[model samples]
Target: MIDRFLDRLAALVEPTILALVIILLAWIVLRLTRATIQRAVARALQSERLSAREEAARVRTLTTLAESAVRLTVILLALLTILSIYGVPIGPLLASAGVVGLALGLGAQTLIRDVIAGIFIVLEDQYHVGDVIHVNNVSGSVEALTLRYTALRTLEGAYVIVPNGEIRIVQNLSRDWARAIIDVPLVPEEDVDRIIDILRPLLAALPSDPELGPLVLEPGEVFGVESIGQQQATIRIAVKTRPREQWRVARELRRRILYALREAGISAPYPRTVMIFHPSSPQPPASS
Candidate 1:
């Protein structure tokens, strides 16, 4: 009877110690992973090549995403190892998990797709928070991003939630730089050369303006006479600016163009109307 009891205790003891060792190793690995991730992010952000704002935004976003992925993988692997050490049949467990996964996949395909898309988006560096993007016909600045969805804030202050899978096309307006393109329409009869000459000085001076100097990266370019319609001629001016600065720069540039045109006495095209009034026929009938 004592021999049987001793044998039973020994078996219990071996499994318990093995389980404890597995847990301890998992804990150590998790701790080291966290520390390594933190150090990598810190080092990246501290690099002197990027501006403070750029480093902060980019590092913070990518770091959060990377840590999330790593933690999930570590936890899952640790769970599986612990189960195997406890003599749980991994094959049967995996089979059951597969069945459950299939059911979840059928029911939650959209969710799974979103997660996969988000991972790709992050890995590819498609865009990040604070970047202005147009997706699914909704144009907004990315306010937040996660593995499931992205939150955007439009110019009108409306918040939009977009699932990663639903985004078929992404137009990222704020990446490394942005462009401000403005079309100025004038009467077709106006001299295109005169307009271009008038715009040259004004556009050229944009980069020198203290307020716009930093924002404007590329020198202004005027594409003269973009199109000449019957009534109007369009002159296109495009300028490069810092990311997300194009909107303000474009708006201000348009305002300046309008003011310059008015000062120069340049008139825009207007629809013409011709009226023909016939009173002679009525007067002749009355006399008769």
Candidate 2:
């Protein structure tokens, strides 16, 4: 019985030591690979013209993705190696894994598509976290992004999850710059040139205002007489502003324009009703 026990222990020692070594080697490889990827990404980004914040975000995103892939591969390889050392047949295991993978691929097509789309989104820099975007008829700020879905926080405080595969059109509202457009309607009898004259100075002075100066990118332009209708004429004014600032600028402009129009005693357009009074059908219908 003692000899039998000793023989079993001897048989286990080599495989156990080999498995430990393989695990240790995998750990070392993972650490080195992560460091190398970080260095490579940082070095590559130095040549691009990006803000410090943008650079950091991209680096972090890419490094995380690469690390995850590498870790998964290394772990699978280490597990296979450990199994083989224990005299487990690997051929059948590999065949079974392939079959399972094929089955999963067919079963999770949507998931695969979403992951692919997410990868492209990150690579193309379509949008990033904290960016205000319009996708799938929903306008919101990106709260988080992952391989399968993107989380959004709408202006109304609703949290939404959207599959990446469903995002066919992406409208990034906070890219670089934005435009503020305001249309002012007036009574048709009002002189458009006079209104433009009043608006020109107000718009020109926008860039000098303390609160709005930083947001304004260029002086406002008045596109006179966009359209003339029976009761009202539309005058369009546009201003270039910093990104995400267009709505605020537009609101401010509307308020200022309202006050100016009121102070100038200019009447806004209102529907007019005409009542025609006629004698009752000449009393022809009263023959009861």
Candidate 3:
């Protein structure tokens, strides 16, 4: 009875110790892999000129992807080792996995393509979160970026999700700088040169104002009479500004122009309508 008990204890203790060792090794390797990946990413991003918040976001995105890949590899290796330790033949399992993987590859090709495209986008720095971009005929500010899709918040408050694979062209609207070009329509009878002169003072003072000056990189310049029509003439006002600031600057300019023009007794152009009373048309009753 004693000999049988000793044999049973020995049989159980060896496999338990071996299994624990295998698990420990797997854990150590996972930690090392993660550390290495993080170190590599840090080194790669050292030369990138990014703001503190932007850098953090970029780091988070890339590291999350790297860690996910590492975790999958570690899990697969650990699972295989454990199965082998239990006397399960891995050769047939691997063969079956390859066949299934091929089938899944065919089924999820678009998913794979999207992830690959996303990786390239991140690497190339084509665009980032908070950038107003145009892709796949949709224009919006990027709200979030992932390995599969990009989320955008439109000006009208609509959220759009675009698959990375479908993004053939990426037009970044807010990159280093932005320009605002506005057409102000006026009476065709007004002198083009005189209108430009009237707008000159407002344009000159724009870049010197405290609040808006920072947003404006260049003072506004009015291009006289962009086009002439029967009723109105289009005057072009252009300004270079910091990224995303052009909208605010443009709005402010419009407000100032409207008030100034009103003070100067100049009227903007608008469509005119006339009512023709024909014989069959109804007319107002005559006062008694």
Q: Rank the candidates by lDDT, best first.
A: 2, 3, 1
**Which lDDT tens digits does candidate 3 get at residues 80-167?**
9877876789999999999999999999999999999999998887887778999988999888887799999998999999999999
- Cα lDDT tens digits, model 1, 1-288, are 999999989988888888788778877887888778777976966754766666667776777777778878877887888778768889998999999999999999999999999989887878887778999989998888888999999989999999999988999998778899999999888888888888888879988898788899977899877888777879999999998899899988888888888898997778766579977654455554
What is the C-alpha lDDT profile of model 2 across 160-205, one tens digit per residue?
9999999999999878788998999998888888899899999999
Best by lDDT: 2
Which consecutive 10 residues in model 2 have the weakest lDDT in total?
279-288
Per-residue error for 165 in candidate 2, Å, reads 1.8
Q: How far in Å is the alpha carbon of 242 misplaced in model 3?
A: 1.3
Off-target runs (Cα >4 Å) in candidate 2 are 1-43, 56-64, 67-92, 228-231, 267-281, 284-288
How much is the lDDT of residue 109 in candidate 3?
94
Higher-scoring candidate on lDDT, 2 or 3 = 2
RMSD of 1: 5.5
Structural similarity to truth (TM-score) of each candidate: 0.72, 0.75, 0.75
